[model samples]
Target: MTAVPEERVDRFATARQIADAVLLEGYVLYPYRASAAKNRLRWQFGVLVPPGYGRDAAEHSHQRTECLMEPRRGDRLAVELRFLHARRRTVQRAVGSRAFETVEELALADRVLVPWDEGVEERIELTFPVDELAAGEVVRAVRLAAGEEQETVQEDGRPVGRLLRRHEQVDAVLRLSVQEVPGPYGTLRLTAVVENTSDWRPPAGAGRDAALARSLVSAHLLLGLERGRFLSATDPPEWAREAAAECRNEHTWPVLAGGDGRADVLLSSPIILEDHPQVAPESPGELYDATEIDEILALRTAALTDREKREARGTDPRAGAVIDLADSMPPEVLERLHGAVRALRDVTGAPADPADGQPWWDPGGDPGVDPDRDRVQVGEHSVGAGSRVLLKPGRRRTDAQDLFLHGRTALVEAVLHDVDGSVHLAVTIEGDPGADLWRAQGRFRYFQPDEVEPLEEP
Candidate 1:
């Protein structure tokens, strides 16, 4: 591995914070305990199961990412792969002096232990020069062997029960290859692949759980550049747009993650995210469920009863830490979790002083603006709050999921105008039962004036 500079190391630390959150995104959900139904289906992302065991659509044997980067001579790239190793835990009861029988739960004088699968963190790092990758493919063998662990429980020096944990061996292969992208500029496209080459096969008609035992849970890649700049797979420059579109990414997507608009690092993850994504600085700590609202989870965890909390503590160490954190959080800290006003910007897009420009903050006070009554010209007609329109999202959909709304009828909630003088229509899907809730939350899908067509009166 190349020796990273002090400044580059700091960037790595920043990236690690977000990567850790991704690794544990669905490890546990609200309530932070195993008893929760949602928690039972945890480890939802980046799981690559063994060959014959992964017969279902949810399971897979490999993941790959293709990204573009501009590298000069002597430039180097470092790739770090992170994942979770699942450890199956079980409890046994003492039936005789030297014999024991497997049990579901074990209770001792101090605590009660419940059998649950726990994850241990694993990391693999590799580095290569630009010339080396461009010359030919670089491959590395990734292997973690099968193992078992045990711990004994005793009452007054007499053995009462014991715990057993085990994991299956995993064999994987990591390969990387690069090619110069076609264009007027000197851009290179890098293809990185990770495959579950583990020869382990499950018994006939085995379940998903058996397959997952040999899987790489919550796996992701963090790539760093020494003297080169990587392009964003989500949003590429105009010149590289055609080339970027040609890149083939499978199961995972790469996004710029070096922060502050730096292009020296890329985080290819199974979870879709924008370029330069950051963990909220206001967050209290890692709740292990990034998909859920941190404030809501903390509040719910704080509301758990004493008995419920005890079961949560016994379920897993991470869950216990969550319960402890919620109990120790102060009112002031909770308030911060509510929200933060990062900045105040005027209609012209310049920073505003809350002292005197407070009136501008309220659009209702400004006679020139009225979200409820504002009208914007859409095609040949004008559309307002009470009008209806057909949604036609832009050709370049940043979120592919938005395609589900194409050609759908929507009620216009507002016609908004920004500093650039561009008009947008905020709308909610017609006939949706949750439309009222969405409106109350001020959440609506937005499209440009050209992307909406005024509907005819019925």
Candidate 2:
């Protein structure tokens, strides 16, 4: 094959990060519950089945995951394949009333029950040896399993049926193969194949197939590089890095490469081979659907109650700020604001009405005053100097900073407004390191009016 150009090398690191994000949380989804219908079919990537249908019918099922890897000359690539080997036990019970039925016919005709029996068997976690393969070379590893004997049926501690030994020898086989593809840059392609060489077929179309598929396991490859360096999220190619950075809540971003050129660049994520049309192209690794924002907003509005709103203002800083802003307006103006929120919720299919009979915002007979100059109130407390505030967790935050101060207390030094008429708070923590670090190093954190709560004075 013709070699890919050098400029294309930068994309490899970004692609590896995206693939890793998918691999780490490949089977995990939001509202993680197996009973959820949407979560029933968890495995959506690189699924392979045995030649015959059904779990027990097929002697062996194999799945292969492959990814293109680039390594500099004289560098070794460490490839590791990790996965779970799930062995299901099948129990046979006679359906019809036949005491003297032949063991062969009974075994063939009996209904099979696949259950998770305590102390029955343990799942095997298979991990291949980390193979440091050289560029342009092929490395292959295989594992074979010996099947075990199981009883067909037991009646009152006595064996009523014959002994059935299923797939007596070579029950399963797992293979890992890595081949170095000759290219302009030293490039290697790694492929990991898992074969269910046992004669066990999970029931068809009962979600068991998907469940079994998910049990296959995840894999990661660590490559040592010499001349080439991996790109960081801060570097150029913002398009490649933004998704991984923004969706940190849903996916993990492992340090793919270090600052030094000599360190190993790790692609520690599974390669998803199957296509998922449900996932948006921009955020392929997102656990929740892109439209989940609408659903979440709808749920919030539908469940909005006066008691809940009061409690939110009392406890939640963000909600309190927004509520206080609404509370200062005239009753008719408050009605308009509530109507606007309800209208937005209506567009998103959320219940627009508040739980209380009263409107969302009731100023309680407004006192005539200049509304433009009034200080914003957060739960009966105005945003002013010396006010104790709590930070909101869901506030939009800049990248590269940890959420260390969320829910923590801070004293407001000043309440400032922006050119856009948005409110901001300049605050200082009690034990903050220093003012110099706050200003020069960006250690000082600022909050939007809606991102903080004004606490009642003690």
Local distance difference test scores for all models = 0.83, 0.41
lDDT of 2 at 48: 32
Worst 10 residues of 2 by lDDT: 112-121
lDDT by residue (tens digit), candidate 1, 311-343: 777678888888899999999988889988989
- Total clashing residue pairs per candidate? 0, 5
lDDT tens digits by residue: candidate 2, 330-441: 4453333332222342223333345545333322223322223346677666767667788764445534342677777887766555434566677777566685466455
lDDT of 1: 0.83
The runs of at least 3 residues in candidate 2 whose Cα sits more than 4 Å from the true structure, single-residue gaps closed, are 1-34, 47-74, 84-207, 210-458
Q: Which lDDT value does model 2 have at 5?
A: 33
Instruction: Please provide TM-scores, in order, for all candidate models, with all chains considered together.
Output: 0.75, 0.31
For candidate 1, which ten residues in a row score worst on lDDT?
357-366
For residue 449, model 1's alpha carbon misses the true position, in angstroms, by: 19
- What's the lDDT for residue 117 in model 1? 89
Model 1 TM-score (2 dp) = 0.75
